[model samples]
Target: MGTRLLFLVTAALANGVALAQTDVPAQLRVEETRASQLMPILHHLTDIYGPRLTGSPQLRQAQEWAAQQMRSWGLKNVELQPWEFGRPGWHNRLTEISVTAPFQAPVLARALPWTPSTNGLIVADAVILMPPGMPAAGRAPRRTADSIQAAKGGVAEPPMPKMNASPPLPTRAELLAYLESQKEKVRGAIVLVGPPAAPEPDFIPQPMRRTDAEWMALINAPPGIAPGSSTRPTVEDGRLTRDEINATIAEFLVKNGALARVKDGGERRGLIRVESTNGYGATPQVPGVTIANSDYGRIARVLQGGTRVEVRMNVQNELHPDGSTAYNVVADLPGTDKSDEIVMIGAHIDGWATASGAADDAVGAAVMMEAMRLLKTSGLKPRRTIRIALWGGEEQGVYGSQAYVARHFGSFEHPKPGFAKLSGYINLDHGTGRPRAATYFGPQSGAAIVAQKMASFRDWGFMGANTASFRPVSDSAAFYLAGLPSIGLYQDPFDYLSRLHHTNFDTYEEVYEPDVRIAAVEVAALAFALANDDKMLPRFDANDIPSRDPAAGPRARIRPPENHGEP
Candidate 1:
């Protein structure tokens, strides 16, 4: 009887090992297939649906399509959760700009979203307003009848006159002075404003996946040293306060009867960087447009040479009422044992209207959807429920995620019953880069737990995990502020900052198939591990708050100097 029992025990152990070996490769293959097959999903979200500005009809369509897709994939509890977004809805139907005087040429430009539209086609003389401290170029010499007669006599014409160098933009006081002195010149003309003061370089190095040693140090470091200790210098003081200076400029231009305000495009290679209209909650004082730098430079040269420059522009935009409700798409895959516990993953679904927001978030959304599909279809029934939330108003201020947390899990100031059941929240909104590591924003006690949970996937190129104070930039900010275990996936830069982020070039082609596929596999594996973990992830003590306001809601109270909520 003892020999028979030993044989059965050994056979059971062998079968368990075999199952474990088979599970990894099988799940990996499923994710691989998902990665390669993501093009159709990408096309549908970006190409077919087009730009999904929050609260717009297109975004509503996208939310419906995403919810339907989730349901079709067998995800349960699929619904479009509504939230109050305190902003007016806006859409741009038509925009056109061209140079009509001194030379006829097309000028590439895009109207700022949500700004007031030109009543109709406006043809006005262009005026280049140079800043203070720089001298304006002298007028070019004109050819007289005597000069033409002399040139006809075969004598060399007078040497061409030299043009003075372009001037730097004016300071606040100088700008005020220019506006006062040239008020009439700027009035009734399309004024081209110079770029603002150059900002200081961002010296902070981009974060990569944490190494094992780094993770160990994070677990051992004292409070205020590891997280929330960044002493990065800010350029906020150097910036012209938008409401004070920029708004004054806009008001002054409008009061002076300016037809439209055109600014030089900051982007290189003809890329038009578009943004929302100025002055939230109110229509802009004047219509605004961003002209390509090359064309703008040409106009500036002509104006400096004392030549009249004219431009023709037409912009058609509409603003809906402010009370329109935005929605977040939510779906779930039920768990088995600890069904009440939850592991959540999300990406923002809304994007700017200038381009298909493929790289900014569509890639992350696709990965989340595909990961859920792989786990569900692969027959992996986790011990805890897995929830997927495609957020709205993230681009605005992470309103969708904040509203979700406040409604379901309660805000930091007010804890609810659902808060305790949450195991962890994972977010991937950076872009379509490959996932290399993760940053954990929970209590120090949870570091070891995360490390152990992530160890199995080290072979898949996970750099391990490190504890860091969360920056309230992405949707993870809301979860972190509430002291829940939250994480942001670290990824390769992949031109997300330099080129594609929020630009017209952010289209479907920016997706790198192999890298995105790897990211999908990593995200799916992480979600599965978190869901199946035995214990709930630890949270920071209520008093141990990060360097941010817990009650600030979606708009992160602490914004970086470079991004002062311009959009």
Candidate 2:
């Protein structure tokens, strides 16, 4: 009878301990995260600092500010870790593009980064420059029988004009020769490349979240469903690539004394999608701009009506000297017994210079900062140290994170002293949407561990865990390729892809406060849990670490220093 009573008592004590362990996350959810505490951090990153393009002065200033804030919060070992950028840093000072002829109107446009300034305002006539064999736009064509049958059968139609078949694009040599032939016409004109398509109307409402059915389908689907690496095609692509073609056209413009090159921005509803110049050097000789599709279409229509259109443009840009480098912001929250082991949370601090880059990465950097603050203020003593890295050069080629990993913790082919001591990394770079669940890239058992650890925050929309479809192409991919355990959060789409990404609309107003607050709290809880766990997150064997493309991975192409100026 005494033995039975003692057994019951022991079981109750064990159960009590388990309950306390689970309650820590619950306690954090209820007490630590507050909107007032979080929004100010985000405001400083976006509103005050604006876009932090890698190697730009704005990014350098922001990195210093972030490091100072981490130290003031009682975090230790804060530093601005530097890495070679290998090219001149460029930023836009002023860009003014307007349509003055046929009728006075303002055209929505922005200069491509790393492109040259026009030196001053220049007014010039416009000429249409289409690629060889690309058919000119005309009246709508009648639908073919195949199209009608495909529509009736609910099959997707082919992605081309209905009945207006066009010849194949010219070979590379042929394209160059054709451009040489048009030298006289392009010598002194602002070239408009290609006709613009009318924007299609979107009828469906914005999705709040993917349904369970949709997620399951995505999980079960074969690999390559989602996008892979976005590395541009090179000489090895076996044929003429669009990038090569564009580069050739730009070279032609430079040689032929063209005033500038303008194209449709390829976005809907007057939104302009911005991108950098393809050149690896400081800037190109001829300037380039992508205006709103609506504006481009209007100009094309006027030109088709034989009414000559003229444009006036004035652009200014600055480029840092050769051998300039960018930096990553690093800090640490020391632990109790397991201070040597590290758990990392990171987000990129750099973004495209289109807007303030609020959704692209400002929200992400804010989340990491707030997570550190939450853990510190809650007086939690984790077992492993929690580190935060605000990475730079992620927009260029994820250079900051890769450089840190290679320097501190070497890759699978080469291991450093700290390689084995690191536990795992959690990265948030998706957008301002709430983090719905955690996805890991490792053994199958790690999913169960993550699901168990995240049970406490189920109501905050973090309920489940799943294996990643493929390795991430963001900052996390660096760690993943290095054979370290890495985790990523799956969030709602929330205009990140359709409207905001790399566009002028990525301002502070696009951020939803409540959602990002939840994201910060979830990151804090997960980091703390991983820190105190008995064992680290499961990792794949060295042999199982998948190899990635050389072009798509960390190492970026370095241009010669001599090419850092106008020819």
Candidate 3:
């Protein structure tokens, strides 16, 4: 908070008028270590059922398991509501890749999510060339039109582009970066990869944050970074063509998967998290991590520079048709006097096929579950019905919530009920950080007193309401699009993100009990207060309309076609 606001807050506290601190009872203790009955429930969802990839058999099993668990929890009307989605499923079984020839050390690699695995140890000669320019596998000659044109100019015939070019594994980090840099067009080599590592906000920034062994190695330079391990100080020599980089990564994935190559220790390691793992492409067959120039030189000398290297790898996986039988786990805490009105809290249950969906949403789901579980267990029934929705197919889009809104708020496209008797919506989807209040979509004045109370969670030192403003991104966006005011709560993404997030590293070990407990209290307290409060969160009264016409509109405007072969 700014100085003036702090002063105002201080002044308000001194007055003792008790303005907006209505969300929690003065006696509620929101400290870390507060245990919930639902903790074990969340564990089973994450540990037993594992990753609930949308549409997969195991995913379906998980969905059913979630519903059953909720039913066991005594939730009413618990059922798996079916919806259509992409068919089939796939899961990895075997991933083995090794480099043969000049030198060899185990390498770090992974397979793209949803990629067809090679049945056995496939072998191929390594080739390191850029995209749309490298020739197909095993084709000795560059006879393309461009090659001919270049040859006439004595332009040392450029390496032919890959005709048998297979899809590459793209990372979430790269995709987000590309989108940030350009929006006019988003294309490159096709990728079947998974979410990349979201950088850890703190440890990653600390240069000396490495272990004693790592520090010694960095300082000595005698014993270079351990095999398949990376060292500090990454640098890019010159501006590299984005297309070139994309091709390089793509080729790396193909060759690595086919046992053509293994990446040197020039790349960084992956992070693991509790309750979740970004397993999208966490295998020894995919590509994203690249070797450092110094080390890559060794492999380049043999592969790109002509010496042939032999590598072998095997990828085994199962395939399932894409089908979407959507389901949202919903429960109710009926209100005494205002049972008709509703207060809703939610977090998505579906996760990236790669992750365990823990932090990305498990924490959020757990938070939502624990909030209601705490209220009910504590014998604190709400004054208005409190609804909890663990939505399905959220990763595919807000299909679950959208379907709810479209049906519950009939004429949603035309606006009949504006909201679903929704006093407000509170959502959590960020990784398992501590409770840091929330970000809303309104002027400070609108939530003035509430913001003050929200900040009170800060008293615990781990929880504080930032009162920052953020547009909708998760399921809340569906509500926001329907003109309902929503609040997105978050914790410090310091470790939860970089450490676990969506990688295979996302495991139960990564969750900080103190942090998760802190979050649970804050979220429950917020829900309880909101349920008992008199006023509803402010809504967007100005120009609230469906973003686009269902029939057709500017949103569906035409775009120029891609010039396939043109540079």
TM-scores, one per candidate: 0.79, 0.85, 0.64
Better of 1 and 2 by TM-score: 2
Show where candidate 2 strays beyond 4 Å: 1-21, 31-35, 133-169, 216-238, 280-283, 547-567
lDDT of each: 0.71, 0.75, 0.51
Highest-TM-score candidate: 2
Residues 317-384, candidate 1: write the lDDT tens digits: 77767436889999999999999999999888888777888987888888888778777766678889
Clashes of each: 1, 0, 42
Better of 1 and 3 by TM-score: 1
Number of residue pairs clashing in candidate 3, backbone atoms closer than 3 angstroms, sequence gap of 3 or more or interchain: 42
List the candidates ranked by lDDT, beginning with the highest: 2, 1, 3
Q: Please give, for residues 344-440, the per-residue lDDT of candidate 2 as tens digits.
A: 9999998888888998888999989988987786667889999999999777767889899999999666889888888889999888888777667
List residue ranges in candidate 3 displaced over 4 A: 1-35, 100-104, 132-267, 270-302, 353-355, 410-413, 416-420, 442-446, 449-456, 462-468, 497-499, 543-567
| Superposed model 1: Cα runs more than 4 Å off | 1-26, 34-36, 131-177, 195-240, 547-567
The per-residue C-alpha lDDT of model 2 at residue 127 equals 82
lDDT of 2: 0.75
Model 1 lDDT, residue 540, Cα: 69
